[model samples]
Target: MSRRLVILRHARAEHGFAGPDHDRSLTESGRAQALEAGRRLALAGLVPDHVICSTATRTRQTLDGVLAELPARPSVEFEESAYAADLDTAFALINAADPDVGTLLLVGHNPTMADLASAFIDDPGLVSFPPASLAVVDLEVEWLYAAPGTGDGRILDGEGQVGKGEG
Candidate 1:
């Protein structure tokens, strides 16, 4: 079966917050960006059936903002391992996603988010996952079989522009 994977980086966060890095909250602009991102995803018809998010303050806030713009609320898993995960770790998390979900969203930090997106596309250079940016990839495999360079990915910004890989 074909599946859609949405990889999103958390929005811009407060840099000088008097808290741990993981506890930093999103700034005003980040909140706006997160909302825009949700609208973009909706516009592209990529609403997720499940969400696997990092257990970080900024990521959680971003998810909330994105969810606010969506019509349906999908099941969510808050994963601590995604907070500062590398490519392999992120892959492991994604591999563990529920097989019944047709579309899955992974909200977390970068360059892990960017790296994960890059790994799935034909051209890694086509990926540019800045804050609040997301990439929607269509993979012809089960969730457990997800791997690098196995999908056709298109990166999207909050403005809804699509950046496709050169397959």
Candidate 2:
């Protein structure tokens, strides 16, 4: 069966925060961007059946915004490893997903998110995943066997518009 993977970058966050990077929260514009992303997902008919998200505060808050616009909530898992995972780690997370889930959404930080999305396409140099960007890749293989360069998948759609504010 064909599977769909949605790669989402966390929304714009406040800078100069006196906390760890993981503790940084989304800004007002970031929240609007997240909501727009959710609406876009629904409009594109790419609503996920399951989501694997980073445990970072911004990522969680981003997911919250996306979830708010979704008609139905999908199963979600918050994983700390996804915070700053490398491409391999990200792939492993995707590969470990339940085959029963046809669509999976992964929300995290970059350049891992950008790297992972680029790796799926034949030309890795052409893709860029900015803040609050969402990319939809179609994978022919099951999640268990998903790997870099093995996706045989192309980006169906991508949106990098996270509003005209600080990111």
Candidate 3:
């Protein structure tokens, strides 16, 4: 069955947090970007069936803002592994997804998201997943079989600085 993967990089975050990197929260602009990204997803009719998000504060906040704009809430899992996930870890999570989930949203930090996006498509240079950016990829393979360069898919659409006026 065909699957759709929507990869989102956490929005702009506060840089000087006294705590750990996972504790950093989204800035005002990041919050706005998350809200805008959510609205764009809703408007585009790309509500996900499942969302696998990082446990980091910024990513959680991003998910919250995005969820606020979605018409229907999907099944969500906040995983600690996604906090600083590499490409392989990200793919492992994707591969473990339920087969019934036709559309999946993975929200985390970069450059893993960027790497994963590049892997799904034919050309790595075709996209750049900046902060708060979303990449929509249409995969020809099932979630269990998804892998780098194996999934026959292309970037259906993308939005950079989504909620911000910049893009």
Backbone collision count in every prediction? 0, 0, 0
Report clash pairs, candidate 3: none
24-140: candidate 1 lDDT, tens digit per residue: 999999999889888988877778999999999999999999999888889999999999899999989988988899999999998898888888766746645679978888887
Model 2 agreement with the true structure over 26-106: per-residue lDDT tens digits: 999999988988887887777899999999999999999999988889999999999989988999999999989999999
| Top candidate when judged by TM-score against the true structure | 1
- The window of 10 residues in a row where model 3 has the poorest summed lDDT is 158-167
TM, every model: 0.93, 0.88, 0.88
> RMSDs, each prediction?
2.1, 4.3, 3.7
List runs of model 3 lying over 4 Å from the truth: 152-167
- In model 2, the runs with Cα more than 4 Å from the true position are 124-127, 152-167
Per-residue CA lDDT of model 3 for 39-78, tens digit only, reads 8788778899999999999999999999999999999999
Against the reference, the lDDT scores of all candidates come to: 0.87, 0.82, 0.83
If both were scored by lDDT, which would come out higher, candidate 1 or candidate 2? 1
